[model samples]
Target: MTAASLEGAALTSSPALGVIALGLPAAVLLLAVIWARPGAGAAVRAAASLAVLGAGFALTALALRPAGPSAGPPITPTATLPPATCSPDGGLLRVAASGFAFDPDCLAAHAGEPFRIAFVNEDAGVQHNVAVYEDAAGTRARFVGDPVTGPGTTIYRVGALDAGTYLFRCDLHPQQMRGVLVVA
Candidate 1:
C-alpha cells in the first residue's frame, strides 16, 4: 500500500515544547508533595524541591533527545530514463537513482573498459546501491557496492566487463530496482 499523507500538529523543536514536556510531571509531583506536607517552613522546602526536580528533568530530556538528520551530498531529483545510456562524462559513467528506481534501466558501456559508475541516490533518508551479477537470479556476483544513504553519490569502479548483458540491481530493493548493464 502507498504511504498516507501526514496531518495534524507538526512537531517542532522549541523552548515551549521543552518547557511543557519537563513541566507537567515535575509540577504534578511537586504539587502532590506540597499538598501532603504537614510541617512549618514547608513553603521554603517546596520551593527548593521544585527547583531541583525541574533541573534534573530538563537535563535528562536534553541529553536523550534524538539528533537531527545527517548531512549528505546535494542532489536534484531527475526523471527515470528508460534504458538510460551509460555515457562517459568527465571520465566517469553516470547513473542516477530516484523514487526507488534507476533513471535509465537500460545502460550500455564499452567492453573491456574499466570505468567508474557514479550512482547518485536522490531519495533522502533511503539507502541504495548498485550490484552487478552475471545472471538474472543474482547467483553469480560480479560487483557489489556498499549501500549509501541518500542524498548521496557513491562511485563503484567496475573492472572491465566482457561483451554480454548483465544484471544490475539495488541490493536493498532487489526486485524493485533491477536493471540491465549492457557491455558491448
Candidate 2:
C-alpha cells in the first residue's frame, strides 16, 4: 500500500480514534493534579493521581481489544471465476499477476459488459488487490471492483460508462501492475 493509504487507514481506524479520546482527558487531569496543590493534603493528591492513572489504563485496554471476528458489516466473498485463457467470446483479456506485473499487460472490454479479471497472487510473502476504476481518471469515487485481495480470484462486471477508456491496477502495488479497459 502507498504511504498515504497506510496513513489514511491508520488515522481512520477505531483504535486511533480511541487513543485520542483516552489521551486528551488523561493529559488534562494530569496537568490539573500537578498544578492544583491541596496544601498539606499530599496523601489525597497521591490517591487522586493514582485513580486517574488507573482509569487511563482501563480506557486504553478497552480501546485496543478487538471487536471479535464478526464485529462489523459482513463481507460476503465475491464470486470467483474459473481460470480461463480467453474471454467468453474467445477474445483474450485476462490479466495474471505474478512477480508484481499483470500478464497480458493491457486489456479491452465493452461498457455494460460482463468480463472476468483473473488475479493470481504468485509472489510468496506478498499480498495484493485489484481495483477497477470507471475511467482513465483514477479518482476514488468511480470504481467497480473494491480491491480484490490476491492469491485469489474475482469476477468484475464492467459497469456501464461513457464511451472512453478505463483503468485497472493493484491498489497495493500500483507501479508494478496496471491494465486498461476500452469501453466502446
Off by over 4 Å in 1: 1-91
The pairs that clash in candidate 2 are none
In order, what lDDT does every prediction score? Answer: 0.71, 0.56
* Residue 34 of model 1, lDDT score: 68
Best by TM-score: 1
Collision pairs in model 1: 81-103, 83-106, 84-104
- Model 2, 19: alpha-carbon shift in Å? 21
How many residue pairs clash in each candidate at the backbone level?
A: 3, 0
Off by over 4 Å in 2: 1-93, 134-137, 144-150
RMSD of each: 9.9, 11.6
Candidate 1 residue-wise lDDT, 20-98, digit = tens: 5766677778767765777737777768677867776776455445543332334433223235455423436677888
